[model samples]
Target: MSNEVRDELLTVYAAMILHSDGAEITSERISKLTAATGAKVEAYWASLFAKLCKNQDLNEILSSCGGGGGGAAPAAAAAAGDAGAGDAGAAPAAAKVEEEEEEEGMDFDLFG
Candidate 1:
């Protein structure tokens, strides 16, 4: 991404982080920011959203895409504590058991 896009993405992400109390970013907010800067930031918003979907909750991502808000944002505080990779939030023993079950029941043709 270009520097301009990166900067814009960070700005929105920062704002999302700042007001992460599940409050929505209203149209008024978008209009005011546009007026002050004359910058249409929606493209950058789209890129930021695409990146967010890779790891964040799908429901939250879809809701944000539908509009500015009307959905819940993840807890910023929870993100602060490291989850130790894909296994971060999982219970060690439970995850191991699931992994074994997955190996026995793997379905490769699901994509084919």
Candidate 2:
């Protein structure tokens, strides 16, 4: 793929490819992939990208394109259910927690 380079983004794309291919994304590997695609990736940029991604959980990050909190609802519900089974007084606490969670989402409303 001898295409024109798109600067820093090329390095990021190459890193993603390496990650999906189950290859270690070192600066050398990023440089090689960018070069293979005819992109002249700077060595410093490659190293910086490698460093930035060193501790990232790429699999976790890619698992949900829609982002997080899906599991949180189910977990919170289960906790409420479990607590409700034992104590009647615990129900209000659970409801309060849910209300707090909802209020947090309303902090930045789309239609202000």
Candidate 3:
């Protein structure tokens, strides 16, 4: 493909990735690429972006990007609670002592 087409495609891909969460598009990101490259390129990029947004992968990406815990927080908390219950019901003191000993032996300095 020609440089013009490549640049347009890149811009579209970058825009889709950057704007995944309905972020405002700043002028600094536009650089020189724009929708005026060609009607076909513009249409293709729009279709690609639409398809990506419609897929479940977009949700996963957005959830991971949101940094708001998403669905993982509850699951992790439940698992941790279960583990604590199990530990409490079992030998807690023995396990805790071993963990402390292991931590004491861990390297404090990267070079060491």
Candidate with the greatest TM-score versus the true structure: 2
Model 2 residue 69 distance off true place after TM-score fit, in angstroms: 14
* Residue-by-residue lDDT tens digits, candidate 2, 1-112: 4323465789889889999998888999999888898756667778988898898998887775675548698888788789798788888886799899999988996788
20-109, model 1: which lDDT tens digit per residue? Answer: 644444434433444455545554554444454444554565466756563344553355334545665565665689799999887667
Top candidate by lDDT = 2
The alpha-carbon deviation from the true structure for residue 35 of candidate 2, after best TM-score superposition, in angstroms, is: 0.6
Q: Kindly list the per-residue Cα lDDT of model 3 for residues 75-107, writing each as its tens digit.
A: 966776777885664446656887999999885
TM-score quality measure for candidate 3: 0.26
63 in model 3: Cα distance from truth in Å? 3.6
lDDT of 2: 0.82
Candidate 3 positional error at 74, Å: 8.8
Q: How well does each candidate superpose onto the true structure, as a TM-score?
A: 0.23, 0.50, 0.26
**Model 2 residue 67 lDDT score:** 59
Report, for every candidate in turn, its global Cα lDDT versus the true structure.
Answer: 0.53, 0.82, 0.56
Instruction: Name every residue pair that clashes in candidate 3.
Output: none
